[model samples]
Target: MAVPHYAYLKMKLLGPKGLIIVVGDYCKSLECAQAGAKLAESLVIAEEQRQLDRIVALANETPAVPALAKEPAGEASFQPSKETKKVKLKPEDPSCSKYVIVGTRLDNK
Candidate 1:
């Protein structure tokens, strides 16, 4: 059997226990870039926020180090790395003359 033209591609969040995120067209023949953004935001921000909230609640009840610092993963482990960050690419502004949508085959053609 042939593979479908459109499918969700899994993108992994690299970490100790990684997250599997799916990105693909939400609707048939839709702009994939637009769908990718929506799916990424929902998975990255929304799901991550909920997990953080749950962890914060648990930490409050436990007596440990300063609240500002993150708890160690294990007793033998060293302090966690502080390089957690997100790199966002600036979007193309439609108002500027530099933007153009190319290579899309119009149905009418």
Candidate 2:
């Protein structure tokens, strides 16, 4: 009788300061290991996205326009011109744009 070779998968979820947040279960198969790795990666990415969302929400919550000061009579106030220029995006141009793959994980464990 031949003995079956077993593989072990270990994953460590780390924080900004190299602190371990969570530890994954040890997988006996390659497929399970890959799934564990993917899940861990997704968790990290989701946390990052959540933080980004909070920052964006905070930024957008504030008013962009500032209050204008009251001026005296016969005095000119400086006003900025609101001229908008249209921008064209070309997807086929390799130099102008590139494709990015987000939240993709490759596991070799």
Candidate 3:
């Protein structure tokens, strides 16, 4: 007869958030595998967030207000004296718009 399959790869029940790997047939081994999987998942999430932050930084470098057909309902909406479509780089903040380009340049060099 074949050996019965056990729920060793049940990562969702084993850790707060991760996959459980079956390292061996023993229960203790499975526990260790679950821990390792959780650690790996945490690292992966951190790296993904770091990458997204870099992209956001790059996008913020260029300042442009998207066109709104109608002004949003609120007192905050102020009508401009003249229509302008070009994106203007705000002189007040320079760091807001240099991450993506700088990061890519540094990586290339």
lDDT of each: 0.59, 0.60, 0.60
Off-target runs (Cα >4 Å) in candidate 2 are 1-28, 63-109
lDDT tens digits by residue: candidate 2, 1-109: 2222233233455557874533334443657878899999999999999999998898799877767887875538654335433333555675775454322232424
Stretches > 4 Å off in candidate 1: 3-30, 66-109
How would you encode candidate 3's per-residue C-alpha lDDT over 1-109 as one tens digit per residue? 2233355522223445754443444777669889999999999999999999998997798656656588676778763434333332554786655322122223324
Clashes of each: 0, 0, 2
Q: By TM-score, who's the top model here?
A: 3
- Model 1 Cα lDDT, one tens digit per residue, 1-109: 2233334543445445765454554554367777888999989998899999999999898877756876678878775445443323335644544443333333425
Model 2, C-alpha of 102: deviation from truth (Å): 57
Alpha-carbon RMSD, each predicted model: 29.7, 23.4, 21.9
TM-score of each: 0.31, 0.31, 0.35
Q: Rank all candidate structures by their TM-score, best first, as comma-separated numbers.
A: 3, 2, 1
